[model samples]
Target: MMAGTHGQLWYLGMMEENKLKTSEGTLEKARNSEEWRCQGLSTQRSCHFMAFPSFEHVITMDSLCFDSWFTPSWLDEEPARNGFAQDGNRCNDHALPPDATAFVTILRNCAKNKDLRKGTKVHDDITKMGLLEKCSDALVTMYAKCGALSKAKELLELHISRNLFSWTALISAYAQQGLGKEAVDCFEKMQRAGLSPDAVTFTSILKAYGSIGAADKGERVHDEVVHQGLLENDVMLGTALVDMYAKCGALAKARQVFQNLSSRNVITWSALITGYAQQGEAVQAYACYEQMQSEGLFPDAKTYACILKACGDMGAKDKGECIHNEISRQGLLANDFVLGTALVDMYAKCGVLVKAQQVFENLPHRDVTSWSALIEGYAQHGQGEQALKTFEQMQGGGLAPNEVTFTSILKACGALGAVAKGKQIHDEIARQGLLGSNFLLDTALVDMYAKCGALAQAQKVLDELLLRDISTWSALIMGYAQQGQCEQAVTCLEQMQQEGLFPDAVIFSSLLNACSHSGRVHDGHLYFTLLSKKYGIKPDLEHYACMVDLFGRSGHIDKAVGVIQGMPFSDNLEVWSILLGACRKWGDVNVGRWAFEHAIQFDRENTAAYLLMADLYAAVGMHNDAKSNQALRMDNEGLKMLEVVV
Candidate 1:
């Protein structure tokens, strides 16, 4: 049972980790994964990279004594007395014990290398030398940096002379592991122990607060930082504060913090920009990017990547192209796959598929995100065949599709009405046991089936979902309405309401459209009324058009005219066109001419107005009876000119 539970946890943890992995992380890991640079009197983990694989194997060295190893000359208390020069280059075969500087220099190397096997050997030597108290801080740092948190905490607790560095190692390690509550608990205990935290410690705790969305505690930390005046000199600390607030969705606080910072660097500005981008505030992000550049601070690759995201979201094609040019000038895209992916995503979103494909083809390498971006762009832009081709290429490249990849491909399938392909994807989703976890995938499946006119399959997918929201229900209801199954659409709406899901404006639009197609004038009006009354949803132009269409198609010419006159705003060309079509149907000569005149006044360019008028004359079979036949022919000539101009 324990083994099975462990397996389950591992599987879930791995999936979550993979889902959250992005372009920004793996870049530095390529350079900093194995190297650690020491810069301070107190020990510090690698600032560039945080993740380290846990080392499990333990090496026993019972035959070796504590004082049996020779160490670096710097660790020697009196190098001259030991016949070693200050900048000594010593032979390795010498027989001096490596344990004299056991507290720092040796453990620093172990932590730097993440060599737990050798670190454990040194641990035994430290214990045997009766120097555990003296060496505990470095030992704890070693364990933490080696990805052995339990051992680090065990060593930390057993030592009576623990310092701020020891506590910080554990806190930072917990933060890196995403154990925010544990990090907070450790921080409180360290404060209780009377060890004041430094800037590094504060940065780690702010990251903890951000990870868990504990903005309240983070604000308190901000107060403490302000009380200490820590932000006066440390740009990194202020950036962390801004990042914390941003991650907590407190954009105002983040902006306030950013504005208040005494010194702003590229990283500081990037932190604020990234915050806005992550919150979907693309305009703000773009504004900040412009401001950042005007300050003469060139953006780093990560900043460029983030700004690309903002451009993609806002569809700022020209700005995106300018940034792309700058990126090319810097030669940043050659080695940076993330930047390349961002470029593809930006162009894809802008509907500039040719350039997007060009950038994609020129990319040095591509990952799941890069491929997924192109696929989603293709899917959304109505290039279903291209999306399908990209998806096949991604598979041929040996990339197993994640939830996002599958969602994009499923949309492509839906757009193409490829139900057989959708079902194959559905079976794959089921076999992977991926059905119950991601709700977007759930909604996409239902939407795909509904779009393909496979209403039964769509409904079954919805029913089997562990959790159903308005979106899933909306997909099914829309499917039924679109397939002309009006009664079923109405039934689904009631069922959704019974499940305590209030209909949104979109659902009402679907309902009204269903009523229109079925010629259910009474039902359509009731829904349109309820749209404002019970639902408090303001019926937009689309809803009004549906109502007009409903009454007009049912030969209720007066009610259709009433709908047009009762509209809260000016009727758009579509509404007038529908009313004109209705007038043609019932041969209401006066109303038809009035509708046409009003429609043409609002929309002289569209040929629908002229077409509807002609249809009305032909429908009444009263070409000679109508005096406007000559005027209609003149309008037809006007339409020919309009078409040429268009």
Candidate 2:
């Protein structure tokens, strides 16, 4: 009995030892399998169940267990009969795979399709299988692609062993969402983790830098690309490099990379063209477009849009019309609202309001941009009533006017001196909260008030602005000048200079006009001298004309003649007319006759010269010469009327 009891104890002890060894072996196998899975996941391709050799037997067993769960017949069954239904509970009795590779595949598909609902369901399955920690990177990628950035960030933070794939996923998510600075921060953290970024990673970060105009960061990344030799044989990276540099306003570098590229596509060409267009290098943009066509690369909708913008910038109406015809041929305008808007803007900027309206009316859908473009064209062309009508129509169509729209319409009101309309627009602008944030809008408001002869209102708007640019100061100064408030205009000029805002040609023109209207000859000469000497602004024809009017208005005929003679260009009949008008004003017949003869000699059809000469002759009692001048003016007027009639 004792020997039998001892044998039983030994047997029990041996059985316990074998059980312990078996448990240790299973735990070791699981750890090894996890490490293997991670190594495969770290590769470029998606992680597949077959990639994990250690888990193959387990996956095969799970596949058998869940064979009925994924069958074609099951997929076609009703929601209550299928185990894979989004809300069904038929699969609750069966256990899913430990690694959840099948669900991961489904999540990847959901991400590709951008289906958040299915992705969420797959994530729930992953969580229930207790595979969330292992499959965190896949979840991040899915959430990122689905635009669920918040959920992606949560998963990224929860994952402890955040590898290159994990970091790249988050960085890409930030970039796609236009969170450039956040993407850069993630890139820095990734580098600190001692993992080198691949070409795709570099491209994503470059896009981020481009979107935010972070040229400094983009340059650093370019250096990295050079060091890694990643630009060779990588067309996508090369295109991204070109796009980044172009968008960052480094056109020279962009061109260098583009020329050296082994391959060039429409995307790179369009990027370069867009850069030139945005920089106002319209000639270069057109040249690039022609060159692209010569190289047999057709323009896409974006490329066409960019070139149309270039045409508008340069006022190349013929080029714009040609592009319009091409776009119509391609049927691009039928469905592409952006392209249609570009067409409208191009026509409006080129001073072809009729064409702009035709295109606008033909558009299947018109956004605020289309309406704003037409309104701006009318305003710019001094068609105030038409602009207001268009604004009302836009409002009637239930489209809210944006800042550009309001600015255009306000300008129309100012041009027509419609004070009531201007006030109503002002209320709307204030209600939109656009006044405080945008200096341009505020300047527009001041200009509107000033143009309407409401100097006090203009001054109030100027004073309330938190920040003021040269345009803001110039607008108020011009307002005072137009209202003959010469003292206030000069004071504003002094204040603007004291505040370190250097006056440009526009401000100088306004100042000279103020002096001319107020008969401040000395101040006009002083400002004219300061314009050239202090500010280095060469006087254009407008400035010279203002000076002639200033001298002529102040009873300085010889000084006015001196200005006309001193002008660099001699064919300016406007200046001569100013002198002639000044002679008539002060009754200097000899100088007036000389000015009239010279004006007619320069431009034989100058009606102002003829009219001024007739008035001067009549003022001095030269009735015969006055009749001759009047007859000549009548003949000119008859010819003009005939031309119009024809």
Candidate 3:
């Protein structure tokens, strides 16, 4: 009787095994059939299924066999067709698990399918069926696909019981969300939870560290990677390390790491190159690019862009042009804004404005930098009118000029001393709310007004500045000095000193020039002494020239000559000219001869010296001496003074 019961049980088990095999075979065959498609038919899977081959094959096979044979007539009656597969809940109770599994498989497909959305609904239905705990991997995967990382984490904590794929999915989700810090935190928590990181985990976290420039944290991770014996000389990790070090301004360390790379792709080379370029080390940048090509590593669009910028800074126009031709040969010219901009700036800096304008006009989209480059090009060439016209055109193009643009325009105004135009630009800058921009613009405005002989306007901008830099003070001082406003310049100088800002050589030079223009000889001498005594600023040749001019202009011929002779250094042509001019004013032959001889010796080719000596001899009625000096200048040196135009 026991043998009979055992035989009956074996027979029933065999029947169930056959049923399961038939069910699976039917699903596979239906999926593999060529008739399956997503034309006008309302099916869960379609021709788009080809993108996810695994899911497509399974869904097609299951739909063909399960939908027709086992599907309830009520599901077909309620919807036109394919309703059961579309809404997995329409499946009978026995088919629910297979349907849920199918939906999960579709969710895991990386081929970007519209059916993935339906997979989300099926996943929710699976949760309702209480199968989520039983199928933790599937639930975690579904939540990850739907971008419901919190739900994914909840399922991982509650049902996963162990993190194998769960850690990877969670880390990747964090990375995708750009929560790099959160990704690192998750990685640390995973380690605390006793999970060993895989290659994917390390790569993802390394990327996070690189993005945030967490150099110390990245180094720690690198040490852990080496300690774990997971350092496999992978190019991705090397690239990440280079990027991290580069972003951190540790170019030396970046170079060390980059050199240790056993193999480098274009990205590795490009990262190191860009790092050097950004640090203003264009020579190193180009050298690496050359080495990359020598290694037979071809450059892409990004590589070309970086190298072009390096070339521009280093003034390697030949190299830049060669790269330009290469870019054109590669047909990468259309969408390359960086390369285009770099080309414009390169040509502009090289003084090839025509070429720069051509490049600027050809750009598919002209950004602010493009216009700024062209405007600055004109400004630098002293084409102030052209620069102002370009600025107007740029504003008309619906592009508001930035600080750099305004700075260039203001500089042009200063160069031309176009006070009205400068004020208009100042008002426009204020209207655009860029008053508190860099001190460069403020300094430029002050310089413009000062050069235009508008000291009050210059002071207006000066007072509005919250904290003035040295250039601000220098601008106002130079303006007053140039206009012979000695008192005002001295006042500004005092104000500058009271602000605890020590003046440089330019300030002193401007102050001395002001003294000369205003005939403040004593004050000029006192300030020259103060430069050395109070500020330890040894008077340079310019200061000496100003002092000589001060004394010479005041008819102190002997004092001027003494000042030139008493100079710590040998007398230059400027000092002799000042003394000679003073000798002419005072009509002192004794001083004039010495000054003329010294002037000739200091500047052997100075036509002015010859002319001045001849003029002095003529003034004293020494026609013979005058004639001899003139003959020597003409015959011995082929020197001849042309008519002065200005």
lDDT of 2 at 617: 70
Give the lowest summed-lDDT range of ten residues in model 3: 5-14
Give the better candidate number (1 or 2) by lDDT. 1
Tens digits of per-residue lDDT, candidate 3, 455-548, equal 9999999988888889999999999999999999999998988999999889999999999989998899899889999989988898888888
Best by lDDT: 1
What's model 2's lDDT at 594?
A: 85
Give model 1's TM-score versus the native structure. 0.76
Point out the worst 10-residue segment of candidate 2 by lDDT: 5-14
lDDT digits (tens) for residues 184-279 of candidate 1: 998988888878899999999998999899999999999999999999999989999999999898999999999999999999899899999999
Candidate ranking under TM-score, highest first, comes to: 1, 2, 3
Stretches > 4 Å off in candidate 1: 1-107, 113-199, 211-214, 624-630, 633-646
Give residue 174's lDDT in candidate 1 (0 to 100): 95
Could you give me the TM-score of model 2 versus the true structure? 0.76
Ranking of predictions according to lDDT? 1, 2, 3
Per-residue lDDT for 358 in model 3?
88
Model 2, residue 272: displacement in angstroms?
1.4
The C-alpha lDDT values of all candidates are 0.79, 0.77, 0.72
